[model samples]
Target: MRRIAMVTLAAGVLITTFSLTTTPADAAVGFWRTVGLSGVDAFGFYDTQAAKVTLTFDLKDTKKDGYSAALRFTFTGTKKQKDDVRVVALTGDRLQDKWQTVTSTRLKHMYVQECRGTWKKSKFTIKKCGAWRRHY
Candidate 1:
């Protein structure tokens, strides 16, 4: 009985260790849009392993004519126990209806970050923004 218990405990420990090591880092996703305007919408996501940001913008209400939207991503993280950051900018044109792009960067230490997205349109003067915080 003692030997059997020891073997079972050892097996459990090995399984747990393997599971932890094999687990994939969590991906962060967020959404944003112009507050008063329903026509412009955007989605953004962060991949922990790839350390990339993907942004997609849609010109939902196509009733009007040509318009252009600009998106900016602000990322904040820590590296070497100190502050680190990276910023990327992407633009989407309404003529095509939808636009998406991805950019690569180091997400810093702790696998945690705060990302904020700001969006504006050519015809629309005021800028709109949204934020998401991800932890792993």
Candidate 2:
């Protein structure tokens, strides 16, 4: 009986140790806009193993609206300060489907916003923007 109890305790301890050490699955957050003549869909995920953020965008406009799709990413660093802000605009073929990966060790949280923009003189200007969403 004593030997059986010892074996069972050892097995339990080993299982617990393995479970605790195993890496966690990636986490994701997303938003979409399909009500207007144009549409935009996006998802953001945190890759645990890679220690990075991956953002995917899908833009559609069957009506051929002049406006373009855009995504803005605001990353907060470990010091609780805004570290980086980036804006990506997609037009024509590039607007259909796109994905971007951000690798930054200092990134602690991310704020995302979707917007519609117009191009003029080789510059993209945001005309409308949606509410900001946050992910950590």
The sequence of per-residue lDDT tens digits that candidate 1 reaches over residues 15-64 is: 99999867365665555443333334444444445554444444333323
Q: Candidate 1 vs. truth: CA RMSD?
A: 8.8
Q: Once model 2 is optimally superposed onto the true structure by TM-score, how far is the C-alpha of residue 108 displaced, in angstroms?
A: 1.8
Per-model CA lDDT versus the true structure? 0.43, 0.63
Clashes of each: 0, 0
Assess the local accuracy of residue 3 in candidate 1 as a C-alpha lDDT between 0 and 100: 100
Error of 2 at 13 (Å): 20
Question: Residue 126 of model 1: what lDDT?
Answer: 27
TM-score of each: 0.36, 0.59
Instruction: Tell me the spans in candidate 2 whose CA falls farther than 4 Å from its real position.
Output: 1-38, 48-63, 93-95
- Using alpha carbons, what is the TM-score of model 2? 0.59
